[model samples]
Target: MFDIRLRIPSWHRLHSFLGLGASLFFAFMFLTGTLLVFAPELDWLRYSEVRASPQGSAKLSLGTIYDAAARARPDWDIVTLVRSEGAWFADQVTGVRPEGRDAFLWVNPYTGQVNGETSSFTIHAALLRLHEALFIPGRLGKLVVTVFAIPLTATVIAGLFLYRRFWTGFFRWPRFSSRSRAWLSDLHRLIAVWSLVFFVPLVVTSLWYMVETVGLNAPATPANRTVARDQLLPPDFNGARLDAASAIAAATLPGLEVRKVILPRRPAQPIVFQGDHTAVLVRPRANAVYFHPESLEVLGAHRGEDLSLHQRIAEAADPIHFGTWGGLPTRILWGLFGVGLTALAVIGIIIHAKRVGIMQQKIAGASARSGFARVWRGMGPWGLGGWLSVGLVVTGLALLTRNFLGA
Candidate 1:
């Protein structure tokens, strides 16, 4: 009889190696992601100027707001005006300054006053960059981050396989009176079992990101008509037609709540009115209307309902992954689970370290004489080498990205 067990790799060792190898990176991502869940609110809390009194309705027109932003920053080329979702939130007007850097001005819709300004590198932007690419620059960084989905998915499967009866552990509590290792293991399993709901969707969305990053499952975009150079608006255009264009957009798409107004920057660009309609899970940009830059004439419109199946799924990915589909409650739930995932990584590391310490205590020969040799023995040659390699690669990539961005 063939010994099938002999050919199979040790699932326990594989699980530990996979989990440990990416645990630090996973913790970092989880922390940053959790912060991003309430990024807007964080900024609102930090910057008092972004806060506004709850007005029943907007007192000023979109054109007035645009003019106010332009007057506030005369040197900048106003690019977008994002409408506030809440009455107490200030509308955002973003513009490109010299050297192509963006500046955001918070304008009170009720008064058309520019409350304050911030650079493009706000806390949210910095955290998003770190979460998406670890600040490693272009497509390469994105690919590197997305590729981790493979190991992460594998680790989850291996974990579930190791604890085949994970469902039974849902109601089980960790024994506080037990040894530290035993309690830690119990807590780890308990958290993992409870977090299965979040983990499944997280893994699915992460894999989708990997697919998209590699250009495998590209989503279809609406075909845009190019504007001629001769049709471009003059530099001194005051955006007086913005109010009329917005009204036209609202009439074009019934029930459309315009969230963002993207202004044209170049001759071949159109003013874009991006918003949400009755679409359930799609993004604001999913439903949009385009207009001629100078004429304010309707060019085309895209309904969220008109999206293909693949495109709908792609559109839903971010909302699902970030738990934004359900508003505040889901975001809170996602943040809690994110903390749980972070704890799992930390607990897994502690558990492994304790186990390794026990193994080292039993080895009392010359091989464990020096601190380096002891660490080598404790982690094993492969484990130490893998950690070292990851550290070096991450450091090098960070430096390279910094230099690239600087240049």
Candidate 2:
């Protein structure tokens, strides 16, 4: 039923070595990734009351929602208005207060009622920062995370070649009665094979993100250079501007469900409506309609289908990375797989360390200890488990301090 092979390929060794060396980073990614799956749900915990949907047959227009937000915080500058999830048609206004504090307010799209305001600092945001950038300061953190992706991608590629019998062992599981090493080995291989499809795509998407972030294939046009969403161009319009609701209603694609409406505060800037099709797995901003802010005339529109091959691949990265393409169930599945990958990394490290310990013992001719004892000692006081434990505690404390304790 199974082929007994004693020989391991060079790629297998390389894969194991890379995974072991990068186990902590991989673990961190996995842990944060699992948290990110329910990021929106986590936000609800912080804004339970504000996030609640109002019951009504008729929906209030975006103009009313904007008016409500303006009424609530007349002094604050509105940076963006995001369409909130669920049937309530709530809009989240994120902007800066005159005193310079970041402000976040919610408005019911149906009743034009202010749902309440909250600080911009959220648990979801913090965890996402950790996941995306590893808490390193600025783009450097993102660069560090991206740098680690190179090795991660290599590990996945090596694994594909290293475990050639993956298909054959697809249904196998670690034996409960086996020795620790045997059980771990079996479990590691089982996870590696079973998760190949998801693992490979995730790594590829990660690489794609890194490439995009570093501007490898960025659009050549000077106008196409992306601007940070929070960075505001000073408003030149002191007079009343055209309403966003009317502009979006007129400009949006027939099937496009608007997810965000970005207003233009400066001269010559367009009001952009970003949305997705009703189809599953489609990402927000998969299609966008840009309108002349004053004239309410369509300036330009870009749909996912209109992208070139390379651009399509680049655009597809986010949806695939977050598993948002398939909705909630897929997100849950990806979360579970993330956990398994983390566990696999731990197992891989332990197995490699154990083997290294045996080799060290043989070379040293030391009989002071044997088996797992030797392995444990070889791992030293701040070994894999020790480092991981410390990391977890520190991460928890950092997040708790920043969020709950306001450190």
Candidate 3:
């Protein structure tokens, strides 16, 4: 009989290979994700135009704000209006500016004044693109990013198995007085044990992303009606009827607090009021009311409570993955854990280098050829492929940045 153990690769080696292979990508993901957790606050700090002072308990009508935004950029086609959650936040109005570039205008809900405009290519938006697709265009980029989840999941599982009784490491601190490798090992285990909580959800959600991207377990397409060309809002439309439409939506969904108003720019698209109901983890888009473009009549409505089980899970993924369910406090906790995970990836490489004698070789003034050999040997089996993948992604990102900056 053949021994199964002989066929299976060593978990220790597999774990190292997987971790080392994807270390750079893992660092990129964690860093960008952590920043995205507080992207709104970061944008607020970076752009003064997004800041506003609350005038009173009530805000100006949505139509008035819409008119103000349209008046501010008469040449542009208004697309969407995102209501601000905080008293000091300015409502955002997105429009298609000349040359087809998207522009974001801040509208003060109280004063109905267009505060200022900013390009859609904000720092946070660029970070989001990098995080989601590494600047690779189309579904290919998304698939490439999602595929890494498999190795990440395997690494986490292998880590748990390798470090048996990982629970014991929870209270243990790194031994600073010990040798470099010893302390590094201790620190790696300590961080890995503590970050399991974050890793579990991250891997799970990442796998879900992969599944959805591959067309498996995809969320149901929202039901919306198409209208005729004549029914579309004209170029000179003043949005005078948006307030009545909003009132109709509020009455249609009694508890819905509208968060976004998706204006129709094309001929067939309908106006959409995306909002939140009483559902705890579902996104605002999950609970929405669609309206006819010309008549402003209610076309359809979706409530979070009415979603299918798969749909509900899909809707909850974003909030859970980003730690947005509990708002700022949870986001802060997630960011801290993310930083710890990022450090683990960096430290894992250092520990591997030290273990393989690369550090000592370099310290002893080893020849360039020997150093290169040692570095190559440290990669194990999966390292080369991982680096090649990273190289391709980096090339794509560099080209994308060049074109974007040049444009």
Summarize candidate 1's per-residue lDDT along 251-308 as a digit string, tens digits.
9998898889987677788888998898888999999999887677788998889888
- Which stretches in model 2 have alpha-carbon errors above 4 Å? 1-9, 54-59, 88-90, 220-252, 265-268, 278-282, 353-364, 367-407
Clashing pairs in 1: none
1 or 3: which has the higher lDDT?
3
What is the TM-score (0 to 1) of candidate 1?
Answer: 0.89
- What's the true lDDT of residue 5 in model 2? 53
* Each prediction's RMSD to truth: 3.2, 5.7, 3.0
Q: How do the predictions measure up, each by TM-score? A: 0.89, 0.79, 0.91
Q: Ranking under lDDT, best-scoring first?
A: 3, 1, 2
Of 2 and 3, the candidate ranking higher by TM-score = 3
- Flag regions of model 3 displaced more than 4 Å: 1-8, 217-219, 234-239, 358-376, 381-383
Task: Give lDDT tens digits, candidate 2, residues 1-407.
Answer: 56545455588667865666567668767878888877877877767545656675666556666767877887887767887656633567887788777767978777777878877776677777777775656666566567768888888878778877679888887886977877888899898887887887788888887887686763521122233334343344221342544455444677776778776554445667777764334456657777554445676776777656666676677778877767678888888888888888778877876676667768866555554454344333435633553464466447546555552
How do the residues 1-407 of candidate 3 rate in per-residue lDDT, one tens digit apiece? 98988987888988988887777778778887888877888888999988899987687777888899878898888889998777888899999987887889999888987889987776667767777877778888878888999999999998987898999999999999999989999999999999999899999999998988888764674758675686357555566788888889889999888889988777888899988788889889988999887777788888988889898889888898999888778889998998998899888877876777755665776544443344455565645855665685686579568746954
- Clashing residue pairs in candidate 3 are none
Q: Please, what's the RMSD in Å of model 3?
A: 3.0
Q: Candidate 2 has what TM-score?
A: 0.79
